[model samples]
Target: MVRWWRRPWIVPFAAIVVIFLAFSIPPYLSFDPARSRVPQPPSLGVAHFWLLVPHVLFGSVALGTAVLQIWPRFRRRHPAAHRRIGRVYVFGGVLPAGLCALTIGAYTPYGPSTRASDVVLALLWLGVTAAGWRAARHCRFGEHRRWMIRSFALTASIITNRIWAAVFVIALSPQLDTTFHGDEGLLSWVASSAAAWLGWTLPLLAAQWWLERDHLRTRRVHSRPSASPTPEPALPHP
Candidate 1:
């Protein structure tokens, strides 16, 4: 299974499909947008709205950047373009995502447990974004790569959320009558939301760790050299 997914096309194709579904499907869902009635203050001022607009616009760009980073041909041919797009992705993708993390805490439909989980996830998302930005600024290519992997994993949570929601609805539908009966609607909503949060983020983090293990090991080896034994002094007696 691991070997199969390692094929260059598999990840990019999956990422493309996931990004498409993430932007397209949420509007149609009954629970989205409308559930949060009491609006929080916008983090960015009105003038910054244009900057925030790219968050929605360039989600596909973020996914495409991930593909370019992995694909050798694209990386070599347009290194400058890749760097420019990466800047766009970090600023455009991560900055707004961090803001949404702050606002989303108030809007969580589930109880405190889920809201708290979201808070942690949001912090993790922002932390990884900052780390990635710092790595790039320092010209640490390996660090930059690993940090971006983690960042993109968090970003892909949007995709995972929907996939989990669909699965939850299918799995829990039959049980609705027996356990929840009339209250099944509420139960399903809570379950789906919770599943969406964990299902997407956790596996992605795990995958990032796995993929970057060798790079991380190489870094550690290069960082510390073995102490060389002192050369023996020439024997004066000879």
Candidate 2:
């Protein structure tokens, strides 16, 4: 039986979703008050708009390439391709996106909860990607894999955040009147803050747990003693 994780379609499906969102995000990329997700008060002017472009662009690059990097068969068959994509994910995606994120996070007009979450995710994403790159350079493939998993989990958060927001709205629709309206109410803010905090964190924790479990299973297999053939020497002596 094919293992669930080993299913050939899994990575493709995930990649499709990630890429679809990456392409779809541009329509909403405007800094105009009508399209912006966050309120753009007068204090946050053209500078905020400029920073957002790289943040979204490189962030999309990170999201789009991460699945290819993690696709097991693809990585095995095209190691050079995997390395190239990894470089794109780091240099082309995470570095510019993360730096932009730090600036945006500091100046976020949203509540403190969101600012904190954004800053934390930005720093973690950069640090984790850098660690993975260093591990690969040092030829520590196992450590590299683990760190990359964590970094990709953060990359995936961009999509997960939107998904959770939709879920929160759908679930709380009856209770929260402003869910459909343009105005942000107390409930909406609470849900947004909670999603911000949980979006990347839950995925990172799951990835870490999966990596740990796989490592333990590998150790068990390595430590297991192979059975040797029973002695047939008695007939030889005779």
Candidate 3:
């Protein structure tokens, strides 16, 4: 069912489940205080909690909205409803994710290596969301499609993370007696993290670019007229 995957909500819902499972893993749940090299401010705990709550809440809402976004009948029949859901998706999903990105240190499980990617991830989330929203507002349908595709790509990182982790552990199982061998485990984590970023986002961006290429070309052509230049006045017939 390739068609099923095209359904907006299906992919997003799947992403949510994948993310939930990834975070539930023991590695993520057990926070290591010593791992955090970044110094905390007085409000670090409060900020962390606040950031975390919204990420979960908005992420769920975004999944729901994605389903609505893909329903052809709903989009055609009730454009206003679609717009409303879109607004919710933006405010709920993208905004908090961006904020959390800014507070990258709060999520680092083990110092710089863990948190190093946070800035890029956060910026990607916000950039996609903002671009999508702006494109929709301007009625740039092609741009809108591209931006939304990119945004969802980033959202799918959660799923990618788990997939990478599973694959890494399986491939290296023979070499390491245990999955938690010190250097190997760290390397595994790094590899999985990198895969998570590339696996989901890059493909989506490529697909969006390919799909919208013609549309963008059409827009550009229409934007410029092919009218022949009027011959300059014959210098008042000299």
Candidate 4:
């Protein structure tokens, strides 16, 4: 059986889909403020609006660079490029976006659950990315890889949240549209809260699982007997 990673096309395909969604959605699709609730805080003031733009732009950059960074081939073939992009992912993308998340999440017009989730997500993203960088500095590549995977998982939350929202809307349209009306009611709050928490958390969990599996596979390979036992020299003498 072909290993999942050895499929050759899956990673690039997924990366393209992720990058496309991350880059394209914001520019092309217009979100209704009330329904989406993302623009509500920014709509209140110019400062908030400015904050929102950098948060989104840098977050997208982080997400894009992060997708590239995870490619083993890229990291192996272009180590310097990987480090440079990693820098951009952290400083340019993750840090600024995290700060933005903190600012907007606290003051969002959305309910308390969303605010709290946003804050948690932001802090985790920042912390994990920073941890990954520190690990790399210390030459702890394994630790760095794990933490970076975690950070990317959180970064991918921006994409996951949208996916969750789309799924919810499509799957539960009648109930969501009628009872909740998209963030205007209790059900809406519940849905938003669930999405907010699950988006990053689920991805993080999956990343950890993948990392652990990879680690175990590596250990198993290394631990395997490297050579066969030699045959007794002279059974004929016996």
Which prediction has the highest TM-score against the true structure?
2
Give each model's whole-structure lDDT: 0.63, 0.81, 0.64, 0.77
Put down candidate 3 lDDT per residue, 1-238, tens digits, no spaces. 2455466666566566656645543332334433332333455654554455455456656655666675666677899998998898889767875676567534654345446555667777788889999999999986887788777666656556557657866776665645456576466556556655565556566667766786788899999979898887666555
Deviation in Å, model 2, residue 97 alpha carbon:
0.7
- Judged by lDDT relative to the true structure, which candidate is superior, 1 or 2? 2
Error at 140, model 4, angstroms: 0.8
- Candidate closest to the true structure, highest lDDT: 2
> For all candidates, what are the clash counts?
0, 0, 1, 0
Cα lDDT, model 2, residue 51: 78
Q: Per-residue lDDT of 1-238 in model 2, one digit per residue for the tens?
A: 3454778766666867666675656655654535655555357776776777678778888877887787787788899999989999999999999999998887776667878998999999999999999999999998999999899889888777877877886777676655545555666666777788888899999899998899999999999999988977656555
Query: Which regions of candidate 2 are displaced past 4 Å?
Result: 1-12, 15-23, 28-34, 177-183, 235-238
Angstrom error of the Cα, residue 8, model 3: value is 11
> Could you give candidate 4's per-residue lDDT for residues 118-193 as a string of tens digits?
9988898889889999999999998998899899889878778877766764655567657766634566566677
Candidate 4, pairs of clashing residues: none
lDDT of 1 at 59: 49
Stretch of 10 with least lDDT, candidate 4: 28-37
Model 2 per-residue lDDT at 79: 97
List candidate 3 segments past 4 Å from native.
Answer: 1-50, 105-107, 110-114, 177-188, 212-238
